[model samples]
Target: MNAIPGARPPDPKDLVRVRDRLTFLFVERCTVNRESNAISIADGHGIAHVPAAALSVLLLGPGVRITHSAVSVLSESGSTIVWVGENGVRYYAHGSPPSRSSRLLEAQARAVSDPSLRLAVARSMYLMRFSGEDVSKLSLQQLRGREGARIRRLYRQHSQRTGVPWDGREYDPDNFEGGSLVNQALSAANSAVYGVIHAVIVALGCSPGLGFVHNGNYRSFVYDIADLYKADLTIPIAFDIAAGPLTEAVGSAARKKVRDSVREFRLLERCVADIKGLLSIAGPVDIDDEELIVDDLRLWDDREGTVAAGVSYEESAEL
Candidate 1:
């Protein structure tokens, strides 16, 4: 927490809290720059400034270009950057806080690394999705099978309700159009869901690579968290969109609808709480709320750390 002589400290309300911002911002074909401390995006014709720090996730879509300085500033401000293809189908790369706090990471690693604890967490995650079902004795394989069945049933129920043809889940990332309209819509919807989950995972300072049910991919944890909401949010939305008359590109409409549904349902806040509950992580993880004392953070290994000059802050004050 840094307090300048004349420069007033940031009010907790004015702080760039991720939960208050849009779930995620998707930008395409723009050059990112830092004008003073403000982040701006330009696409030749015009320029627009964006509050990058206030954003939870910044999805850099096709033709996006960013400078090293811009990246550094955004990273320092605690925004997660993800580079993806059209409709967020192909994830090219991403950058976020590698490790926010050793405590959370250690806790996550210990739970995920241990066999018994890992399975317990997996069951807990499943229970969160199922809500009321007891998965205490369900093995990982049994849990997976049950999950698949439940999702299939959801697809059927939604299909019947919306009057869309019910087809099994099928998607080919390479040939997206090869599948049915429903499948295409599902793909687009799920991609947007993954983007949000990825941002939250990074912001919480947990390793995305460590997943209980899902494994191998870099975004296993993202998949795990995103799956919890898909049946309720994405799946139904996809069917509704696919059922209605199409006025635009299928993928575009699907993504737009999915985003709208996410916002309406307040899924961003839900995602944060769900992750905290699943990981058994206590307390809040709001980085901006913490007093940013350099010595307290222990940034350097060899050198003695000192507080940033001309910067001190108080936690609470008189009205």
Candidate 2:
């Protein structure tokens, strides 16, 4: 039998350092001294030096280096680097595209349909949203309450568990006027998780716009999958790492810390196992096989439309 998949692997230390290098650029304007092969990012005329050894640079945009060598190294080492650009996020690898398949999509769909699996996803979202607490102890039924009631109860429970002050006021997106430290950190974490979930959904071959929960007009499935991961998996772990003494302002350092933590965390493996268990898949599903599952879902659609499971993929592929 094939061995059970291990935890999500760690990012290379070099990649982490390279990410740190780019982050320095974001917080300050920098000048690259090609003669010295070093980069200096200056803040208010004070310069911070970045060593060339820390990066494998490639020119992508004007005045911007893509860090091609670093990206290649990270991808080769089984890490995913999503570049968010003007056209939206694009996935890249050191060599070839990563494996994604349809059976995994079927498994995820089944997992979402299972009560226990749904609760696990919900609990993960809750814990991630409110760390330093035991939000996982709450039941799925309790979580399904009205938003105001759910938020109020969660605040009180979190406060009681962690002794952290939680004002019951609703979360206001506008409150970050001059950049509240807490708000900024939380927002960054949320965006990071959102990106990860989007990638997962794409890999799974399910239309991210269709979801079993957290319904919206657009990409509801993305929200649903992300919500499942929030409590028990991504958020709490991010908060735990971010709340530590080493945590800093919501800059590249903080973002890297959170991203690295998520990468090292075994959320994906656990998610895969839970999904497989729910779907009763006996073995690991190759991601490249996902188109078949999409075809299956389409067959279901066609049946509902005209009452028939018409031509199979084999027949279609032959044609």
Candidate 3:
């Protein structure tokens, strides 16, 4: 399987085989087999073995045993498995999970506070608005102004630096003839990044709508966090990929391009670092037993112009 960026590099963990189908397993309860080193998923009564090479696996029912050949196919095809159930979704890294920490929250906080980082995010967001890719440009100030002025400014700046055209029109999911494949892939990558950012923000106990920049009546904070990623990482990488070998036809190829670009961008690792850095700058706030560092950032709530006080930076770091 193609390697997932930020996933632990493969190692000699173990190798084992499963003979039965298992289902209804919660993510927290799942474990990898020590002997075959494959993932052994189980509900209370049934069990199944997923080959080690599978990029992603989703358990849809009570009993599902993935055969050795299936695993091989997934590995060779570089496909990710997704589990869909009443509970929630789970993505299994083909190898190992990265070390856990509250660092990403902290970095997010820092990115918002720091001018350079914040500008980076703004630039990235702007680029996304036009080409739907992450390619860095000169600066936010250099871009020309128009309706959705903030967005236009950012995109113009990005275009200036990357030499990619700034198409002010809304994204046309139906039209793929004119746009480059890299542009299409970058857009998909941006969507994925946005999803992850929102998930991380929610995981930290912050509302996604409330944000410092890109304010809206809905989940603004999600946009805020997404904004930070643009400059520091996403924009440059998006542009790099768009300008690279990948083309814009959607489907399996587009999906693969997005995955490959994400890995090549090292977005996951950079995001983790950015979150940690941002939080460290926000400082600490006192909670009951522990200290929570709340950053003075605005988030998007359902109400217009409403800002909720966030958890302390240190507190979010602990999440």
Candidate 4:
């Protein structure tokens, strides 16, 4: 949906349903503007007003230019903004999550800090992935082995089902188009999954750096969460895209297919629910509270007519 000029900012109440309403929006070559507290994106052709609050993730790919006011409106709306290369091949940076409370984030930090609890969470993730296989007592190394085996098996299964030849995971970022068809498709497909899961991870106020199965990078948690759905969702889609007639637009095709399939599966909602379930150390409660702290935004307004200069609205709003 295109945003018209002078549209009212989305109601803060809409934050609760943003995940279910907008899954992912890939934008490029557009200038984002703040109109009547909402976002309006324009190019040389026309102006399209967008509801920044209702999006799960807004992918700012190549050529996208966002204004400061637009950034303020987006953050206030609680949507995750991702800066990435074309077709999301290379993830570079991301905006903070939408929540004001640090309750869930603090819980995540505590669980990941404790050795026993960290291992338990990792094992629980494995059980969920491998269909309840008992890995309660497995060492991290052994768990990695089992995970690798499962991944290999999935590659084989998908290859057989789709008749797409598998020659191991291989791709060069600088030379993506020159790689094998399936390998390129895999990269394209997995990047899309990572983008969506990263949004949910940050939106829930969790740290993307603190991961259970994966570590060391800013996207460790993103990788960990995306891995949960790769075997089932991305793997098959990549294979299917690769199996189609070779074309110059394989990467874009794979991306579009992954996005469509994700929507069909309601994967955005699933990602949010899974993050909550995995991180919930206590009995089930509302892991993500919809209550927003507007005081921070007011501070931003006083400083620069937006959020704090360096700090994101979410960070300023956090208690």
**Most TM-score-accurate candidate:** 4
Our model 3 lands, by Cα RMSD against the true structure, at 14.9
The whole-model lDDT of each prediction reads: 0.75, 0.42, 0.42, 0.77
lDDT of 4 at 171: 79
* Candidate 1 least-lDDT 10 residues: 287-296
**After superposition, candidate 1 runs with Cα above 4 Å error:** 1-14, 44-47, 134-137, 281-319
Model 2 TM? 0.45
lDDT for each residue of candidate 4 in 83-137, tens digit (9 for 90 to 100)? 9997679988988667665556767888899888788778777878767567767
| RMSD in angstroms between candidate 2 and the native structure over all alpha carbons | 11.5
- After superposition, the stretches of candidate 3 with alpha carbons farther than 4 Å from their true spots are 1-166, 172-183, 231-248, 251-254, 279-282, 285-319
**For residues 203-252, what per-residue lDDT tens digits would candidate 2 score against the true structure?**
33445554545655455765655655554443343344434554444534
lDDT of 3 by residue, 1-319 (tens): 9777533424312211110111112232443232243556555756666554432223332234455544444333222333332222112222111212233445555666677766665555455445543335545654323215654565667667777665653334456334564455445445445545543343233344445456564557655556655553444554555555544334224334444554565554444344433444445422210111122356555657546556443443544
Q: Which ten residues in a row have the lowest lDDT in candidate 4?
A: 291-300
Error of 3 at 148 (Å): 9.8
Q: Count the backbone clashes (under 3 Å) in each candidate.
A: 2, 19, 54, 3
Among these predictions, the greatest lDDT belongs to: 4
Q: List the lowest-lDDT window of 10 residues for candidate 3.
A: 15-24
lDDT of 4 at 17: 58
